[model samples]
Target: MPMPQEYQLASQHYESFLTAAREALHLTTRNQTYTCVQATLLVFRHRLTAEQILMFADTLPAVLRAIFTSGWSIDDFKPEFGDEGDWKAEVKAVRVDHNFSNDETPARVAAVLRQHVDLPRFEKVLQQIGPDALRFWGFEASARI
Candidate 1:
């Protein structure tokens, strides 16, 4: 089925945000992760459009199932834009570096996001994504970077 333009565009924007989050949260040795941001974005997008919510809602289960059962690599998930795609699989694509500290991840992410994207825009994306998507991604973040 053909996806609506709004849904496509929103998805694209969300991907952009994901890239930004990854860049913002980069660590030296520990991998940079964005499951939190991704989950929040999915929830935010859901708030903006019913179709987007439905579409993402449908796809997420399968992706998680694949992650759970098949042991697919998170790095295999292609980025839509120019992101370097240097991430690790933790139920979702999370960036990790062998040198980064555990506690620095979230703060680094927040800082990078502030540098690249504004607060309102960030919150807007999170607000639109649905609860289920948030919960799904949240599961991945059970062990936060």
Candidate 2:
């Protein structure tokens, strides 16, 4: 059967997000494996001059959480020893809490992440992350293609 029009449009949006993220991944980073997390956090950290962190903070975490819920092992990307917590852990905690493994922790962490991001900054990051990634992750970008 043909894919639904909504799914097709979402795939397009996801493609755009992948492109933006892929571009961001290439810019510069100390770690290659954590490139996506780095890019996402760079977006979250207000480090990107063009992007706002708050606007897309919620969506970013949602995308990450969905990925983990789908059975991806975040532990595959270990944080450097002495690093307090990174995006990978943060994303995992959200998924675990959502899945009832832990409840209160994700909320607190989400709040902290929110504080670090602002809507305007996040909007810019969203542009970086692309509407496609969001839609691909199941966040609504448009009602129709």
In terms of lDDT, model 2 sits at: 0.36
Clashes of each: 26, 11
Best by lDDT: 1
Candidate No. with top TM-score: 1
**Candidate 2, which ten residues in sequence have the lowest lDDT sum?**
97-106
Local distance difference test, candidate 1: 0.37
TM-score of each: 0.28, 0.27
**All candidates: CA RMSD (Å):** 12.6, 15.2
Candidate 1 weakest ten by summed lDDT: 80-89
